[model samples]
Target: MDVDLPYELQLVTDLRGHEERAWQIAWNPVEPLLASCSADKSVRLYNYQPSNESLKFSHIHSIPTGHTKTVRSLAWSPSGKTLATGSFDSNVGIWEREGGHDGDEEAADWECMTLLEGHETECKSVAYSSSGTLLASCSRDKTVWVWEVHPDSDFECMGVLMEHTQDVKCVAWHPSEEILASASYDDTIKLYIDDPSEDWFCFSTLTGHKSTVWALAWSPKGSYLASSSDDLTIKIWKRVAEHKWECALELKGHERSIYSISWGKGKTGEESLGWLASTGGDGKINVWDIREPPESSTGRVLSHKLIATLSSAHDVSDVNSISWCPREGFEDLLATAGDDGSVRVWKVVPSH
Candidate 1:
């Protein structure tokens, strides 16, 4: 029998004014707000909240000076105090949260802090490490740059990760590890680990996807990794003995290219093997239950079962990105941004 799963989707907000596709969306780690960047050359912030048994979002601010061309990717710092965005103009922008001092009734304000210029082509992705110590960005220029974050110093370029032969689409940091993973149109995922000398080097390469690998994420526990591709499949991988990673399982359900992937935290105080959620060009979101490898298995081996499937979640356009909100109490909430110029939120309920 087919497992029947359902999702309660509510149109949280109609983020308009983007003449082109919306590429990326990110949620603040400390506040109920989201930042979205689009091909319209603008970035917008929304005050998001749950209301009337649904998600409600309203636009509060917009940044037009951050990028001269299309803004493709956005990320928030672990402290939730800073925002970073990447654009087709070959630049990255850092935004700082201002206001909110003692007895200040005004809402927290945001301003562009600095602009990073290095990439020669469009920058595809930007991410802040969990410790907020490093900012990483990947670009069509076929290189990834790591920046050292200092409150007193402007964003300084620390090192460059140069390996991919094609446009790098995404970069993700391992939750608690000193490892960074990046996916590229070159059909490869490169893992960079810091050496004893405090310099980062490419430790390993994961190659299995037949097409472009667009998105990648590390599980919350930092035990497993997930990558989605234009090949229309999601692959789960695990670190094996001696700093090597092997493909464990392959999930094949999406009818189109998978654009984004995210891992969900387990129940309260529970050690989660974790769940993988992905969005695709087919306008669907699928959640996979990542299982632990069998005891007798050698190397990295993971098994996964399709836990839930959401069809037409973004019926109006292609769902470009999916993220699980990072609030301490709202682990079941999922947010999606799409080409329809809207961001939607869904509540995930497990099968009882």
Candidate 2:
């Protein structure tokens, strides 16, 4: 940890269960659960209790995703009833509780209800829309697929977008809209929206990063986007028009490839929009407080201040992913996945 920072990242607990590299960690949108996918071909779910003073996490269950390869990514539905797992087996698995419960019980068994197989190569990422009515996935096949979520865990592919020239690394949906953003090995980010009358199509392509764009996060209000890249920098893009988004700010601090980033509500409330947390091969976690510039500022100005830095967060191993807790009263909490096969929970505590 950097002593000069105004905030400190206090390690709450270490979750040891994955037998191989933990690739990604995601907090349940509506439950006290955090799900992590691993190269061991399994996904582990942990239950957490958060309080003002401290936080506690316990391993609850492990689901053998049966993907025959590494589970690269996993995401929870907005209702926290369904889990989607993407794998190198070129398939996406949709999971639900054994009895269709709402995750009220930690011991409830889970089963894979559906397998959506269309990608010809490895599936890299999966995400659910804000409304929970749609799912988006990307693959090494250089395609992005939108799936319509139906009753009884049924999924229908709505579109197969072939925009990225290389493997798509990640996919993220706007916090409050149907728009989707995808980062890729092609070193670009593509924004897609549905015509409703026709199908989903790319409306904008953001190209500023010199290397592969690894991850993307949207502001709380969905007005801006933050992207991390293998170029070792994070860029903030602002929507200047109905369909145009331009790079408004560039942040450089990481010493290696930036793998993942997340934006969530911050301590400063709505005025600051949120804080951005990023981590990657540098084994460091950096948190920034991003604020919109004053109304008089020109060029859609924005400002950011680094509030905290956690060096060697994974003890010499690369940190693969970082995610912010989205639940009320737990906004200060964060979870990170490391190549050392451990999941660590942390809280951003004020130094003062």
Candidate 3:
């Protein structure tokens, strides 16, 4: 057995709230809550207190969506009051917490405010933009849809993007811009920017991966975008021209289809450059240090090191989703869901 690794995992807890596969997990940006959805046709929210001795997750609430199928993805609104969910039912549900003010949000009742319908088949993913003004959803119908969130919880169809020849796998918005990116089973990634004349239009089509592109994540500063593919590789792209993008780096280390990738700030580096944590079908969590050389001023990445590799993170159960805790007290913590029907929190020990 290999020993003396660079990182060690402390099993925070084996969160077993879902009877079926835990498909996706998300962290609320404004609050200390974590939301997870599963194949059991339900959405579960938990309030996590890192210092709790025995019980780490205080079960905040659980809502049985009553969808005909599985809940596959989740995205919380910027204010943390609204949650958008995508599911196999071919519909998007917008949930809002009711009667909850600043003081007692935990006791607020969550109600399904509205449902957005248009997808021809299973809705694979949904994401809210940084401003919370737009929500994007991708479906197996091979199309991407953008919605305009109104002040009264009503949404209007902003645009439908149909550049992908195959099923759309995931959609992600730029960190601080209105631009959006979508990955597809056709092995292509498309970037869309808001156009003044036409609502939203595709400006770039990124094609390099040999197989289906499963997921895409924008860097914290929006300078780079990382895409994971079924071909067991991750490609990082950056905008070079006005709307064109060039692949800045290609990371190939995973053995199977890469499912999830998250960009975050590295703990001990220049505040701008960050690290990445990815988990996938190979059931391994790989953290990378993406940075430039010392005293280098060209603003170009020199090398990326595989700082930590934790194999069988979820007991080799096809890890599906991972979200690094962005809170100040839990910078090294990550929440992951897998086919084992459980959510596990692991702390990264960089000192190891």
Rank by lDDT, descending?
Answer: 2, 3, 1
Best by TM-score: 2
Candidate 2, residues 1-352: lDDT per residue as tens digits?
A: 3677789898999998899999999899888889999999999998876456676777888998899999999999999889999999999999988852564566588899999999999999999999999999999999999999999988999999999999999999999999999999999999999997999999999999999999999998999999999999999999999889999899988999999999989787777979999999999999999999888878466889999998999999999999999998888889999999999999899876
- Runs of candidate 1 with Cα error greater than 4 angstroms are 1-3, 6-17, 50-55, 100-108, 266-272, 293-301, 350-352
Please give the CA lDDT of all the candidate structures. 0.81, 0.93, 0.86
| CA deviation > 4 Å runs, candidate 3 | 1-5, 52-55, 100-106, 293-302
Position 61, candidate 3: lDDT: 84
- Candidate 3, residues 1-352: lDDT per residue as tens digits? 2344566656777788899999999988878888899999999888866464433777778889867899999999988889999999999999988876674657777888899999999999999998999999999999999999998899989999988999999999998989999999999999998788877889899999999999898887887899999999999897777677888888988998999998877575564357788989999888887765457566544367776778898895999998877666566677899999898877767543
Minimal lDDT window, size 10, model 2: 98-107
- Candidate 2 residue pairs that clash: none
Which of candidates 2 and 3 is the stronger one according to lDDT? 2
Candidate 1 per-residue lDDT over residues 269-334, each given as its tens digit: 353476678997999888776767566777455666666777887775899999988787777777
Indicate the TM-score of model 1. 0.90
